[model samples]
Target: MRTTPVERPTVLRRRSYTWFPVVSGAGFYVAAIALPLEHGDGFASAILLTGISYFCWLIGWNSSFRFTRTHVSVTNVLVTTTADWRDVAGVDIEGGLAGLLRDGRSLDSIAFGGSLIGEFTGYRTHRRACRLLRQGWWGAGPGRRGKGPVPVRTSVEWRRALAIATALYVPVVLVQGLGG
Candidate 1:
């Protein structure tokens, strides 16, 4: 009798919303260069605005790309990130915007659960996973053997990533705005 070897699924590639930062940054730089220089303090303001825009752009672009490119491998024994494999306790799959907001109270519930009024409570990785699953892009299926790749996350992940990127860039922009 012939038997077929079970194929192990691995993440061949990964991508994130990395273009946002790049495009924003490029626009900032272009504007900075193209904008007319005004006399006295206004010149400084233009320069500052340009700098802030560039800073925001870089942060958004880098973080988005970095998070998206991250990949993992699933195995019988464990799941692996780029560096190490740890025993995963569980996988929580939160739906997308519709899933989370379906009740129109999910946002409030999430805030209450986390015990913070406006704290960002999502991870980009989670959103990516959810998206892949929804599109049936994860490439995993049912097997009598065991549980397949678990899905977890929501669009909040993207929001969090954006928030973080913005936070990092905002201060610098503000400072420049003030000084300029």
Candidate 2:
């Protein structure tokens, strides 16, 4: 008899929202170039527009959730955190999949996370995504009983990537505010 080996972790993403960013990013990128040419605007407008485009692209392409037998990794717009199964108290579905920690903290998810408009419209995808995440959490059994430390670490690389995106807006804001 042959036993099956463990497979890869399940990855969940908001595939439906992908096009919004692509279109939005393209629009902003066009504006970044067109505004500088037409209005002869300073670097501020270009910087702001390009920053917006980068953020849109990042949200569309980078955010995701990976659920493994031992842990769950959540990648949001700003950060990517990996939480051990034992640290997860439960799953929260406030139009997205958020992990409720045993210590009363909540880690929000961007992938499959809905906007206020989508929530009001009662989008079904959030519920489905949450159900799958809940199943993975419960199946792991570590949340109830596990050994060793329950560590939740944020990826340094992801932090740096988001920091660069945020930095793009800061200089433009400072320059504009200083009357430059």
The TM-score leader among the candidates is 2
lDDT (10s digit) by residue, model 2, range 1-180: 999998798977776776789689879877665553334365667787978888887787667787888888888765788887778889988766688777677667766665887788676667776888899889887436444445679874556676766765565555544543
Candidate 1, after superposition: displacement of residue 157 in Å?
A: 20
- TM of each candidate vs. truth: 0.33, 0.63
Give candidate 1's error at residue 154 in angstroms: 24
Q: In candidate 1, what are the lDDT values of residues 58-107, reduced to their tens digit?
A: 34432221111122222111112221111122123443221221112221
With a 3 Å backbone cut-off (N, CA, C), the pairs that clash in candidate 2 are none
Using lDDT as the measure, the top candidate is 2
